[model samples]
Target: MTASLQGQMMDMPLTVSALLAHAARFYGTVEIVSRRIEGDWHRYTYRECERRAKRLAQALIALGVEPGERVATFAWNGYRHLETYYGTAGFGAVCHTINPRLFPEQIAFIINHAQDRYVLFDITFAPLVDRLAPQCPQVRGWIALTDDAHRPDMRTPVSSYETLLAPHDGAFDWPRIDERSASYLCYTSGTTGHPKGALYTHRSTVLHAYGAALPNALGLSARDVVMPVVPMFHVNAWGIPHAGPLAGAKLVLPGKDLDGRSLYELMEAERVTFSAGVPTVWLGLLAYMKEAGARFSSLERMVIGGSACPPAMLRAFEDDYGVEVIHAWGMTEMSPLGSLVKLTGEERRRPPAEQRKLREKQGRAGFGVEMKIVGDGGRELPWDGVTFGDLHVRGPCVIDRYYRTDTSPLIDGWFPTGDVATLDADGCLHITDRSKDVIKSGGEWISSIDLENIAVAHPAVAEAACIALAHPRWNERPLLVVVKRPDAQVTREELLAFYADKVVKWWIPDDVVFVDELPHTATGKLQKLTLREQWRDHVPPSARGDADCPLTDVSTDLNADHAGCVPPSDRATRSPP
Candidate 1:
């Protein structure tokens, strides 16, 4: 074969610093509004952000931070956190973002594991820092993301963020570095074991920003005012810190106060045109709006991910309020921008019902991403939309291996997503359930996500989780656990009967249990593992020889004890029937 001729083009490496530079030069006047931890709104321009970021870089350098060293940040979504993102990575240091919501042990484990040189945190985490200071001995300094007046007194000595930057005159120039060098480090939620880190390169991060800002992906532009309700510590806030600035869109960072009222008021005040967050955040906003009989004044679209967006919530946004809802799905390893659900020209021409059905899926892969489903024995599955299998993906922005791990988790070049999913003929991705979370009953597969979505569609149901219970005949059967809306009553008989027409008879849950609340991970995903442990020994009515009990009697039994006929206290020492 003849050698192909290379095109003549500039070979400047893509870096995160370049993105901030472009924003400062072109979108200088664009506003970046943030809610401060001191209960006030802070606003600044991209030019000013660039100056402060440069000062931060100078401060880090003067403090003896070297290239590729880890600089950890424990902060909320705010201007200081944003400055840290640009300054640390811009100066060729790896910006390690630690989730504050993690357990104290996990937090310490992360800090020590990263061998973080310096720790920067918000004032809200002062007490946590004091508690963890003794555990993370390698940390050279702790800087509070606040001024001297707002700084809290802690057991450990801490420096002020603003005070540190005060010495630098913002004259430092960013050093050009290889784009393949590590720029950011984020750990998984560590639901199973110690959270492993995903180290991202500057090249991959810049590419991810381009893909995320694509018209078919997030569709970001300078005309849009964007707000990321997702914390900056989580997968780079799904890469909005990079993508939003790349698009030159005005940004609004809602710190700490993620409740419905605060979000609504902020959105209105800033005229936020676009936003992205997990479904739980939207649930609160929707509930608050319903109570206040409010409507959006400028908000136009929302991107929902982190977990499946319930059909009910989607309809409530689009039908009740005229806002478009985009369903998204991804993993930390993929830079968290894999698939987004947006209608195509042909899809838009379809019936409303058909469009809604298609929108319920996770949607198609963004540019640079390739996905497929595989079955047992490592065989690739077809995109027939009906055959669910293990989902795997590979792309330019995807992680090849986890940080500090010896073995590669990739199988034949694709990263197994640990999710059971399907791809339709048009290449749309449909997530059924996490591979570990899928239910197996009598050798048949059942999707707990489907059950939970349908349950939440009920007006009286606030949130739902379907967990597998030990069964004598089937080995495992599903039990629906629900939390009711305030002042809303739902009987087990009514809820069970409501599922009759919506799903296959066998797919329906065997029993219903109401609880005051369900557990969630730090990122707001359902804690199914915790739920399973809580209900591991639960006996469905069928297994208890009480399948024929009257519906009213079963309702009374469930109401009397949230654990069904047998309360959890009684089942502690008992075995499955």
Candidate 2:
């Protein structure tokens, strides 16, 4: 028997630099629009961006930055910041996008941990650098992403961004660094201990970008004008920085001003066709549009992630503005593009009500991402769509370990996403709640996300958060904290009654508390941990469901020790919360 010979093919490496080079070569004339901090649109071409990127790369080399050395950037989404991304990673240096929203101490710690040699930031963050520079002694120089006239006077000697690049003609050839070399570093927003870094390689980034460009994912193309309202500091703005160029999509970068009016103006002016951001930003846009009685003339799709997209927001975008809403789910560890909610042909043919139900889910896993649910016994759960389990993901882009940490977070080669979810037989993923945020009542698990989503759907409620509060008998019960719409009056009884018709009696919150606004993290996720701490001593108003409650139709015998029963306090800590 003769062995079959493998087909000879070009061994082109999948690297970010290659992605940019391909764009510059094929789509050089494609427009790249950016809203500058000066409240003006800064326009350029992919060719110009690529040339400037090379110039910036040369500038990095001139600054004594070596290959594999970390260069940190604390800037908003704009042309200069985008250039920094390409320049740093395209030239084989690690681009660590530090989240300026983090505490000063955290910024210092991350910069020091990454051993960043140069810190480049926007003019807005000059004050921040001035305050944190004293602590980050490892950073040799500070490069401001501004002109000489706009540069802030700081204690540390600062370099002008344009001046640094003036010497380079962008004629230098890009080196072929190993595809496995470190390219990007992003730190998880640590809820427990200190933030842990996730180091990504060029291969993983390129692969993730490819995944993001797939039609089932971001649906990027050369004709699309893409805008990412998500901060560049967060998961490379959900990998749009690379995916845009890979697909040759015209890119639009919204700078520091991310409010509804500002975003709408930029989107209208740039004629952006696709955009991605958290649900909160979209909510703001919705509010602004409603007030002005305007519609998105060009936007075709909006991707909502960072947190679950409210059903109302999804409906508002589609029903009111004729824009399709794509709900996405991901974390910093998975090159941040895990699953996007896109309907199949068969699903799309269904009735609007049925389709909306499917849209509420986080959607099916992307091509490269594999997802499974695991039980407490370390066994894989069935994809029945009803049984919830710990969501575990394995993919080419998923993180195997934290940067600089010896501990491996993988369990049997699968990275636990810390999310409790269910996967249907059709492979659609429904994220019920985060593992830590799941509220345990008696022996049953009540999904906080489900409750919050339901509560926010109320017209009077602007936002809502469900946190587990200490209970004497049930051990822990859900407390619904709501922020009412302006001038809206909603009684506690009214809200509880509203839930009675939707969820089971056991799943409803014991009481409702109104606040001016619920707290949110830097990335716009509901900070349930802080809420849990703030309402630690909360007292439930009652346990028994109301007589008119919809749950009265179901079995309610508490003595049966059912999963929904409010058991005594002894079994409170029996299992992980």
Error of 1 at 205 (Å): 0.6
How would you encode candidate 1's per-residue C-alpha lDDT over 1-577 as one tens digit per residue? 9999998999899999999999999999999999999999899999999999999999999999999999999999999999999999999999999999899999999999999999999998999999999999999999999999998999999999999999899998888899999999999999889999999999999999999999998999999999999899999999999999999999999999999999999999999999999999999999999999999999999999999999999999999999999899998999889999989998999999999999899999999999988876777777877777888999988999998989999999999999989888999999999888887665466789999999999999999999898877666678999999999999998998888899756667889999999999988999999999999878777677676422224433433433343345533221111
Q: After aligning candidate 2 to the native by TM-score, how far in Å is the CA of 282 from where it should be?
A: 1.1
List of clashing residue pairs for candidate 2: none
- TM-score result, candidate 1: 0.95
Using lDDT as the measure, the top candidate is: 1
TM-score of each: 0.95, 0.95
**Which window of ten consecutive residues has the lowest lDDT sum in model 2?**
568-577
Residues 343-385, candidate 2, lDDT per residue (tens digit)?
A: 9999999999999999999998888899988886777877878
**In order, what is each prediction's RMSD in angstroms?**
6.5, 3.3
